[model samples]
Target chain A: MTDESDGNPIERTGDEPPDGAPPGGGQRDRGDPGASDRELAADGGLSAGAETDSEPRIAFYGGKWASTIPLAFFILWAIFQSGVLGIGDTNGLVIGALVGTILGMFFARGDWKTYADTIFEGMTQRVAATAIVAWLWAGMFADTLQVGGFVEGLIFAADALNVGAATFPAAAFVLCGLLATGIGTGYGATIAFVTLFFPAGVLIGANPVLLFAAILSGAVFGDNLAPVSDTTIVSAVTQDADIGGVVASRFKYAIAAAIPAFVAYLIMGSMLSGASLEGSAALRETATALGLVHLLSMGVVIATAIAGRHIVEAISWGLVVAVAFNLVFGLSSVSDILVFTVTEAGAFTSLPFVAVGETASVGGSLYSGATGFFPLIVLTLLIVSMAQIMIRGGGFAAIQEFLLNSVATNVRRAELTMVLGTATINGMITINTAAEIAIAPYIARIGEKFNINGYRRANILDANTSALGYIFPWAGGVLVGYQVMVGPEGLGAEYGPEMVVNPIEVVPYVFHGWFLVIVFLIAAVTGFGREYIPDRTSEEVSRA
Target chain B: MSRFDKFFAGLSFRGSTPDYDPGDVIEVMVTGEEGGEVVARIGDSTLRIEDAPADAVNTRVLVAIDTWDEAGHRGTGTYRETVGKSAF
Candidate 1:
């Protein structure tokens, strides 16, 4: 074969791909440069420089609207499973997503090969990998801090303050918010606080519903603002803004909502009556001030991240410090950080972090923490793939065009669309981060069309996602907290069924979450904190 | 911006349509073509660019403002060069 343009003779051995061809040889028209480019684009392998332009565009049978069926189906499945059924299973959602993607294949207009190739293209995108990498690092760091007794230290501080029942909700809100911010997992914070702080507050005369709301409010606060938080990471990376910059820019919005929330908890704590439960004194005895040493570990992460260091590096530093604190302060044994067990005593049994047992397995804070996000990570990649399908199929562009032409003709309307668009998606999807991932592309397209700043776009996307995720009864944060109230080892086990706060009862009392959403709504209309593209540009995403 | 400045950024209530001064050079993405001229739309404001390449649409370019109408939030500028591509 002769290269058509260059007139160079090309010899092709049977079934052997030419040089520069992607592995897993596919037919390529070597004579036509455009044909080769199309083949490479379909493969989506190597040739990073042409990624953005060469991306495959898939067409659907039902026009642009049909492209959204995969994601929309998954969202409905999520609502039904997690919201209606009250089953917060990430693995189930994964299955729903897998089925949804396979279903979308039936709607392809032409060659299904392009549609299939698009899945690999979507999964391999840098955006998905970026969030996954950060989440894994953050998972390890946050879990280590938990093993180091960060929650107990806060309980100790709350005990020392002795603010009495009237102020306990306020105090718990602040403390829970701090823990959530430090650990970057609001669901984990919700479980910890509900288990440790909820019963104590009820025993001391704080209303159960108000106290539960306060805890959810705190989770929302941290989830919205934490640099290492999954939602925060998604919002930042989706908007192409650095995590540190996103956190810094969003502080004003978070604090604006948090202040009123704290005050509401205080006022309501005083007004609402509690069941005169006993044993508050017994709960206080288990806490230790030594657990507070991990505060420095949290601080190092925040400071280093804000200084423009990579998130992985910042969390690694925090992990190192937390382990050191655990060992030096004798808070937890070295084995608690990491340990391996085998059926028989082995040479590695002598190691400080190793143990021998009848069953071979691995256990420890780091192991559990990193592994905990596995389900979520898988769900995220699948969701992003669905999103890519939408993008290539022109669903996103069609939606953007409709919104811009009808609803978002002006910048104010654009901002309002973004705020409401995000809130609507999050309301239907039980997992806030997952919902954020699904809706991020829309926010980016709408925001960029109007030249909105990256930080502002990220803040708007995260605030609504974080807030709505906890305010609804089916929300992951609320559901997790409610579970602790009724689970076998929960407050009901000790305090009786009456101690469990009904999820519906706490809806209005989630002051922080309600306020955060309202703040964004007001910001959207009043143009408060509005920024244009020319106002500022974010630093490189790698530094986040 | 410095670390300290980051926390305080975007504190103001910015206008929907901002006015630019003549001779001010700024980098912006060329959003589309208007009446055979390249244009960059920053919020409600629009700037028509002259001397821009045919393929400048959807690409970032530096432009020097040559005329302004603050009331209409519209202006004209001269394209300096292509700086980058759209961020996907």
Candidate 2:
């Protein structure tokens, strides 16, 4: 590669990357000029001529190619545990993290003290701190609404519309999109709509398979666009963008894709829905005004965040309002607000704690709201610590150098690479959030070089991240949806085998996912939404 | 070529040569000495200023771009006392 970078290499008196030093350790022949140049960039000196006179010591690889250990272990573990073993993401990450750290210790060159400090440094990195705090607040607020009947309110609204079989599928897309956006969990929306709305849609002569795909498409939209979504949160924090900025910036692309998907659903609904839904009209539950009240709570959070209040404070306000609304509006009682009732209590049998019986339950909207994110919280923190090691060891920097050199020669190519790379990762992984976390750092490092706005990079990362996971057959979303279609035993006995939709059948109908990918591709090549750095400082748009 | 392609063709970054408009203000860090010339680095590109204050070698300073060659990505600048980069 030509050093198009103007100016002579700084005559480094010291601290320059030795000619053959690779971040992974071990010697290269120094014969390959391209490899040596990349090593220099990744070595943290960054400049051809070394400046600043100081660079942090990185070690433990012992000339055996060690810096790549953490990333290698984590990626392999994610593939095996999630992709192969079909294990939960949280469990796999914890195990992968612990094992990776242990391996880092064995391969690391320095004393135990340095390794321990590195772990601490990584854990407290600004990105991790920013994301963990945001997720905590977002989780609590989301949980509060879910408990206070957000889903039920949406269902009530859908029922009252009483659209024909031809319109029911379109209604399903809109309702499921609202529910998932409000709740910030596409899987939850999938399950709720599949079990509740799916049967209802079928009675109206809505095509079951199309309805299922519509629900999934709605989920892709929500997951891609929702402010409170885990994938959205991860993408923003990793790219040094604020959640509010990311949500606002990505909205155009999301709506552009969704319009086409909605039209497709309407067309499909008309052609496929032939059965009569006459008798099921008797099955309407009174839609509660209280269930709809949670919309105000969601608005409060989004409004406060956009106005530039601290995220922690914004979420706290939303949580408080939600709990209050549940109580004051007669949506939930005091017990439902927060409770510890012992049905069979043993641990809290003493006087300080009260038990209903030998066992006790500790739950309420508040409890579930906050605790719902415990697994993900731990997952985020652990992965960040592991990421910190990779960064300091130049693992990320090496990849950064290669990306800039081999393919992303300019802004357009860089953005396209981000979209394609995120898509490939999400396609192979069964769990969407795991895929997001795995690819986020690379996106951040590569995107930074072109001065692409954090929001733009984050949008690209999340859109493709959510799109692939729900469309692929091995994806957890697709599998779970298929299982639901097949009924309780996966035998399709309850709905009858004919009603069951194969995962492949739904793939073509996942219109929103495909459209989202295309919108981002256009955004990348055209620089439609690109914003360069320092145009607005972090204080204006980010806490990270 | 399409106008759309031409419209987006000029943007590039992550360069070793310091890129700045002729009248742009930039942030630079002074790092080392090269034969009595004070070398400063900006945006990952380093060049010898030929003549700089002795004390300026280890400090971040502001500059006004006097000239630039886009293909070379190299430029010369005189110092500005006010510092520019934010805490973020």
Chain A (alone) TM-scores for all candidate structures: 0.90, 0.81
How displaced is residue A159 in candidate 1, in Å? 0.6
For model 2, chain A alone compared with the true chain A gives a TM-score of 0.81
State residue A164's C-alpha deviation in candidate 1, in Å: 1.8
Q: Going through the candidates in order, what is the number of backbone clashes in each?
A: 0, 13
Q: What CAPRI grade goes to candidate 2? A: incorrect
Interface DockQ per candidate: 0.33, 0.10
Give stretches of model 1 more than 4 Å off.
A1-55
lDDT of 2 at A541: 45
Task: Please give, for residues A343-418, the per-residue lDDT of candidate 2 as tens digits.
Answer: 7657654533244644567776667766766766676666666665665565655565566667766567778899
Give me the candidate number with maximum DockQ: 1
Task: Give the per-residue lDDT digits (tens) of candidate 1, residues A1-544.
Answer: 0112111001110111122322222334546433443232222111132443445556677676777889889988999998889887789999999999999999877788888887887788777788898888888888888888888889989888886888988998999999999889899899889988888888888888888899998999989988888889888887878889889999989998999999899899989888788878898887889999998999999888778788888889988999999999998888898988777887888998889887889988989889988999899889888887776666655565566567876778889999999999998888889889877866775676667878999999999999999988888888889888887888898888767988989889989988998998888887778887767877887433
Which 10-residue window of candidate 1 chain A scores lowest in summed lDDT? A6-15
User: Residue A508 lDDT in model 1?
Assistant: 95
